[model samples]
Target: MGNARTFILMAVMTALLMGLGAMAGGSQGAILALMVAGAGNIWAWWNSDKMVLRQQGAVELSRANAPDLFDLTAALAQRAGLPMPRLYLLETDQPNAFATGRDPQNAAVAVTRGLVAAMSRDELAGVIAHELAHIRHRDTLMMTVTATMAGAIAMLGNMMMFTGGRDNRGGALGGILAMILAPLAAGLVQMAISRAREYEADRLAAEITGQPQALASALARIAQMAGRTVNIPAEKNPASAAMFIINPLHALRMDALFSTHPPTEERINRLMAMRA
Candidate 1:
């Protein structure tokens, strides 16, 4: 059901982009929009990991220096029947983690310094399993694609902004609608996809680790700490905020339309309900 919903939402978002394009320039405009989105998605597919990590100043980890972290991730990846993903350490105080890469074979996982110090071994396993689930289901790639479309929509909206007052006909009204409504609609879809995938990742993580309560605990702890501990990199690069296990931005309000994560309390409750 989640996958179907995601597919439908993506189709709707694409149609929204093309509709806006047709409104602005006609059939040729719609074709132009698609080609642009395709190009962005393809470029992102190959470089999202590198770009995100570089933006966050992530340092690569290995068995030589971070044996415990590396080995735990390797064991979890093995249990999940995935290749051993490259590990990274984020130089931040927020207890958070995220997965990246086009697929499991090329994927990487990164954890904040606070996360390594805060979580118990079982909790850490739960977190690693959650990210592995994301890789397993290819959510990383799916999100990159969605984000590309969302960005394209926002870009169209911005272009309409500068051109809105140029005419007194329907062109002006179309520009008004595009400038205001199009970006709003794109943001809504991005939030929906991100929230749904997080739930699915949590559920799969629980199954893989056989430790729902541990994940629940980790979620609760992360939520508690996220507000007090600042993630400098995430604050500087707010777009990457959605990639983290929790909402890493300390200052942003958690609205459904804008927040990438569902309520942490709700997530914990769902995980606790899965206890057996």
Candidate 2:
């Protein structure tokens, strides 16, 4: 059901792009914008893991340092039927984690120092399994495409203002519409894809580990602490904020408006329900 919703939402986004492009640029322009967006996302798909890791100041986790973490992650990956992705650690006080890479083969999971210190063995296991589910589901690629498309749609809306569109009247109208609607579309896109994917990951993680309560507990603790701590890298690169398990930049007012992830309280409620 989640996959179906995502597919329909993606189709809607593409159609919106084409329709908006036609109004502003012409049929050809819409196609070009989509092609460009696709190309850009393809590149992002290839290099996202490295770019994200570096942007967040993640370093490779050595087995020598966190042997238990390595073992737990390896076990979860096995259960998820995915390769043992490379592990990285971020030196932040915020209890958060994110998974990257286009597919299971190239994936990596980075956990913050705060997350390591905050969660217990079972809580950490639940968190790791959640990330492993993301890797297995190839959510990194799906989210990359959705985010890039949203930016492209927003950009196209702005483009109408400068280009006056191919037809002056049509361009004017398109520009007005894009300006009003582009951000709306972007918000919807993130909610439809990113938020749904998070729910799906939570469900799959529960299935993989058979311990929804642990993840629910981890989430509750993270939510309590995330607002208190500042994640500097997330603040700097706000667009990358959606990659984390929770909205790392929870304090940002704009995030409250656009909200990349689903509500933590609701997520916990669902997870807790699974235990009954």
Candidate 3:
């Protein structure tokens, strides 16, 4: 069911991009955007693991350097029937973590310093397992593809705005409306698909960990601290926010409209239900 949902959502995102292309540019532009989006998927498929880890400023850690964490991930990967993905650590104080890679064989998992210091062993296992699930299920690939297309749609909207400015294509009021509405619509579509994938990932994580409560606790703690502290880098590059287990940006009411993750309370409730 989850797999089917993911396929459907991906198709929807692709169609949305095509429409945005047609609206902002034209039929030729639509073909161009599709080509761009396809090329991006190819790029992400080959290099996403390195790119995402680099974006987070994560550093490779070995058993000699970070023995416990390394061994923990190794053990969980073994249990999950996955390769031992590279482990990384971030310098941030926020308790957050994420996984990145095109597939299990190429995967890497990174946890913040704060996450290591803050979570109990069981809780940490749940978190790590969740990331492993993402790696195993190819969430990284899905997200990368989605980001590439959504970004193109948003960029097309920008191009339309500027073109309208110079050509007087839609006159003053009409141009203003296109400039404001187009990107907003595209962003909302991206957000909807992102949110759905997150829910499915959460459920998959619970199955991988076999202990939903731990992930639930970890999520609650992460959500509380995420709001109080600032992930300045994430704020500067909000497009990558969807990659994290928790949204890293500062609180904005509008973020709810475009949240990548489902509500924390609801996620926890679903986790708890798994025990029954």
**Candidate 3: lDDT over CA atoms?**
0.76
Deviation (Å) of 201 in candidate 3: 3.0
RMSD of 3: 2.5
lDDT of 2: 0.82
Model 3, residue pairs in steric clash:
none
> Which portions of model 2 miss their true places by more than 4 Å?
1-10, 161-164, 167-177, 251-257
Ranking the candidates on lDDT from highest down gives 1, 2, 3
Per-residue accuracy of model 1 over 1-276 as CA lDDT, tens digit each? 545654676677778888777766778878887777667767888998898889889999999999999999999999899999999999988899998888889899999899999999999999999999999888877666666677788788778766652342256666778878886787677787788889999999999899999999999998899889988888887667777899888654535447878989889989999995
Per TM-score, the best of the predicted structures is 1
**Model 1 score (lDDT):** 0.83
List candidate 3 stretches off by more than 4 Å. Answer: 1-11, 23-25, 165-168, 172-182
- 86 in model 2: Cα distance from truth in Å? 1.2
Deviation (Å) of 217 in candidate 1: 0.9
What C-alpha lDDT values do all the predictions have? Answer: 0.83, 0.82, 0.76
Ten consecutive residues with minimal summed lDDT in candidate 2? 1-10
What is the lDDT for 276 in model 2? 84
TM-score of each: 0.89, 0.86, 0.88
Off by over 4 Å in 1: 1-10, 165-176, 251-257
